[model samples]
Target: MSDHPILFLPGPTEVDAELREIMARPLIGHRSAGFVDDVQQVCQRLKWLYQTSQHAVFESAPATALMEAAFRNLVRPGGRTLHLVCGAFSERWSKIATDCGRKPELLTVPWGMAHDAASLRQKLASSPTFEAVCITHNETSTGVIEPLQELAAVVRDASPSTLILADVVTSLAGAPLNFDAFGLDLAFAGTQKCLALPPGIATYALSHRALERARSIEGRGYLLDFVRAVPETEAGKTLATPCVPLLWALRAQLDRIATEGLARRFARHIAMQHETLAFMHQWQIEPFVADSAARSPTISCLKASGRDVRQLAENATKAGYKIDQGYGDLKGKTFRIGHMGDHTVARLQKMLAALLR
Candidate 1:
C-alpha cells in the first residue's frame, strides 16, 4: 500500500499508475527539439479537449498564476475589471485584481448560488464599459458551476468589446467547454483538478482578440506575458522552462483522454455525480448547492446535516483517504467530495462507502 492517503480533494487528484510510470521517464531539456515536438503535439491534442481551434500553452505554475496573468496582460494597470463573484475562488479573483491596484467592481451572488445572465445583463447595461470581466466557470469552493455560455452571450450583447476571461480550473477536462463557440477571450485550467494530474502546472488558451488586447496593454510582465508566450507556444516553445515531467504526464494523460473519448469522459463525470448524489441521499444529507442545475459535476458540497464534518474528514483520513471538511465559513456545516479527475463511479462509490463506514 502507498504511504500517502488517496486524494479525494478538489485538486491534486490521484495521478494513476500509467501517468506515474510515464513521469518516471528521463526528463528532457525544455528547449530540446524532441521536447518542442512533444509540446506541439500535446497542444494540438489539447484543442480536442478544449473544443477550440486556439492552441494551449503549458506554464510551470498553478492556475492562480494564470489568473494574475490574465489581469496583467489584458487589462491596463488599475483598469476597470468587472468580477462576477459567487464563491471563494471567484472572490479571490476580485482580491487579486485589487492587489494589482485595480478597483474591481464586483457583482456578487450568495455563496453556493450561481450568477444569472439576466443580472449580468442588467449590470452591464448600467455600468461603464469594463476592460475585462472575470468569471469562474466552476466555483470549486461551493461546487457551483456558472452558466458560462449564457453569460458569454449576455456579455457580447451588452458589452461587445469587453473581454471575457474564464477560470476553468475544475471544469476543463470533466465539463463541456467550447471556447471558440462560447466566444471566450481566454479560458484556463490547472492540471491538478479534472485533468487528474498532480499540482504545479497550468494550461491556457486565448482568442486572437485577446492577443491583440495583450499587445495593446502595457506592464504585462516577463514571465506571464501573453504577447510573448502565445506566439512561442504556437511555434512549440515556451517563454520559460516548463515543468518537463508534468508536461510528459500531461501528454500521456491527454492521449488517454483521447482514447477514452471526450464525450465518454464527460458522461463518466456525470455518472459519478449521480452516484455520489445517490449516496448522499441514502445518508439523508443534501448538497449545499440546492439548485441542481448550478451544482458542479466535478465536486459535490454536501451539507453536514448536523454531523461533525471535521470528524468525518478525520475518519476518512484514518481510513487512508483524504477528504475535505469543507472550506472557509462552511467548514463544519458542509463537507466536500471531489468526484472529478481520474475518479470513476465505482471508485467514488467505494470511497463514499468507506467515508460512511
Candidate 2:
C-alpha cells in the first residue's frame, strides 16, 4: 500500500486484499449468463448478510435511491409516513418521502440522543395510521446506534399494519441485526460503509408485508418501483445495466465476511470501540453521545469543547491518517472516528497515536 493515510471515515472504509484482486477481473456484460451467475452468488451472500430468507434487490444506484424507492412503493401518493430522525442520513429519508408526495412527519430527537421505544409507542398512539415508519439503525453523524430490535417490537405492538423501514447503511455486517427476527418490513444498505467496499451498488430487502404494500401502490416510476423490480432481481439481474466491477467486488467481500464469521466480526467492532473509549478516557476527551449503551460500535464521536476538531482532522490527513470532522449541524462541534470495516484494535491504536499527538 502507498503512504497515503489509511481511511478512518464512516464510509469507503477499506478494500481487503482479495477484493482488490477480484475488482481487477475482466468485465462482463450486465445481462450475460456469466454476470447473472455472479449476481446469484452475491445475492445469496447478501441474503445472509441481510439475515433474511427472502431475496433482496441489489441495485446499482446508491443507498439514497433505495430510500426513495421504499417511499414510492410503500407509501402511495399523499399517504402518511412517519420518519424517526436523529441525524443527517435519517433526516434525508424524510426528505425523500416529502419529494415523493408522500406526506411524511418527523418524530425527531436531539442529535446525540437515541429514540426510545416508549416515545415511539406514544407517537403511534397519538398519530393517525401511517403507511410506513422509517428508521435509521445507526446514526453515522452522531455515532449513535438506535435500539432497532426493541423499536421494531414497539412498532408491531402499536400498529401492526404499518410497514417498518430501516436504513442499516453503517450497521449491516458490523452489528448483530436480524431482519426476519426483528420483523422489519423493509431495510436497505450501501456497500460503501461497514461492508468495506467502494461506492456504487446498494442492497435492500423486503418482507411479505412490504412486498404486498409495494404491489398495491400505483404509478411508481419505472426505476423507483419495487413492484417492478422484484421480478428482475429474483433472477439476479437488476432492472437495468448493473455495476459489474462493484458486483464482483461485493462477491469477494462477502467471502471475507463469511470467513471472519459475523459474530466474530461484530465482536471485533465492539472491542475496537472499547479500545477507542479507553483512549478517550486517558485523554480526557468526552464523547458527544453521553449514553454509553446508545453509542455506535462502528463509529465514535468526540465532543470538541477544548480542541479544534477541524484542525485535528486536517492535521491527521496531512500526516497520512484520514479522519472526519463532525457532519451537518454538528460540524466543528465534534469529531468522528470510524471503527468499522476491517479496522482492528491494533490499527486503531496506531491511528489514535497519530491523532493524539
Candidate 3:
C-alpha cells in the first residue's frame, strides 16, 4: 500500500496518523504565548512520564548530544567518569566522554548480558571517587535491560557523591523507570523510540544536584549549556528555536499516552514482549540474552538458528515490513524486533504471522 515499509527496527517507531496530521498544521512562533504554554505542558507531562520531580528540559538535537552534554556539565576536565559497557550504546557513551577530553574508565561485561550490581560495587570500591557513572538502561543493540534500580542502589551505597547518568533511548515509556525514586541524577531519551515521535529532538531530566554540578563546571558550551537552559526552562521557554512541529506532535502523543494510563501502557509493552517470545519459540529460535530477567520488553534480539538473517530482513522489506538484521558486530548472527512505542500485542501477532508465511 505504501512505498516505505512499516518500521520494526529498534528506533524511529511507527507514528500515529493523528499525530502526523497535527504536525502538518500551520507553524507557530516559538516565542508566542501559545507556544510557551505548550512547552510548559509538555515538560509537566514528561515529568509524569519519567516519574520524577526533577527539572525536565529538551534540546534540538539527538540523544547522543544529550549524552555529551551530561559529560560536559557533570564532569570537570580530567575528572574521571565510570562507564558500564555491555553493548553499542553504552560503549558509545564512553567514547563521547573521552571525546569531551574527560578521563573515563570502563567496566564492560560481555555483549548480550547485563551489568551485575556485585561487579559494579566491587569496581567502585577499587576505583577512586568518580564524578559520574554512565549507564545505558536499555542496550538497544543487545536487547538487554540492566537492573537499573539495583545498580543505582549500589552506586548510592558505594559512591554517594557520584552522579548517576542514564541513557534510556530505547527504554523510556516502554519500560518501568522511576527517576527520583530510583535515585538517578540524569536520564535522557530520544523521542524517535518509545515516545512514538519523529527524530531531531531529545529530552532529559536533571536533578538539583546535577544543576549544582553544572554551575560549578567550567567551559560548558553555549548551545547545550545545562546552566543556561535552567532559567529559560523555568520560565517555560527554550534556549533557541526548537522543532515546533515535533512539539505539537509530542503534545498530542502525550495526551494519547495519558488516555491509556502509564501503568496500562507499561503492561501493554510487557504483553508485546511475551508475544514476541512466543513467536520466537514457534520458529525454534532463542533469544540473544540468555537471562530472561535481563531481556528487554521493548526490543527482542533472537539468535538466527542457521537462518540467513540478512535475507530474512530483505524478505521482510519486500513483504512491506522493515526489520533489523542486527547491529554492529552482531549483524547476520542475530536479528531484533522492536515492540515498543504504540505497537501492541495484536499488531505484533499479525507481523509474526506474516513472517511465518
- Using TM-score, give the best candidate's number: 3
TM-score of every prediction relative to native? 0.97, 0.97, 0.98
lDDT of 1 at 185: 93
Candidate 3 on 15-125: residue-level lDDT in tens?
A: 878898999999989999999998888888888888888888788789989999998899998899999999999998999899999999999999999999999999999
- lDDT for each candidate structure: 0.89, 0.88, 0.90
- Residue 21 shift from truth in candidate 3, angstroms: 0.6
Error of 1 at 192 (Å): 0.4
Q: What is the C-alpha RMSD of each candidate to the true structure, in Å?
A: 1.2, 1.3, 1.1
**Candidate 2 lDDT score at position 317:** 77
lDDT of 2 by residue, 1-357 (tens): 335668899887876677878888888788888888888888788889889997576888889888888887888899999989999989988998988888999999999989999999999999999989999999999999999999999999899999999999999999989999999988898988999888888898889778888888987789757777876777776788888998988888889899999999999999989998888878888899999999999999989868888788877777677888989888898999989998899888887887777
Give the poorly placed runs of model 1, Cα more than 4 Å off.
Answer: 1-3
Q: If ranked by TM-score, best first, what sequence of candidates would result?
A: 3, 1, 2
Worst 10 residues of 2 by lDDT: 1-10
Q: Where does candidate 2 stray beyond 4 Å?
A: none
Could you tell which candidate, 2 or 3, scores higher by TM-score? 3
Compute the lDDT for candidate 3: 0.90
Candidates sorted by lDDT, best first: 3, 1, 2
Residue 120 of model 1 has an lDDT of 97
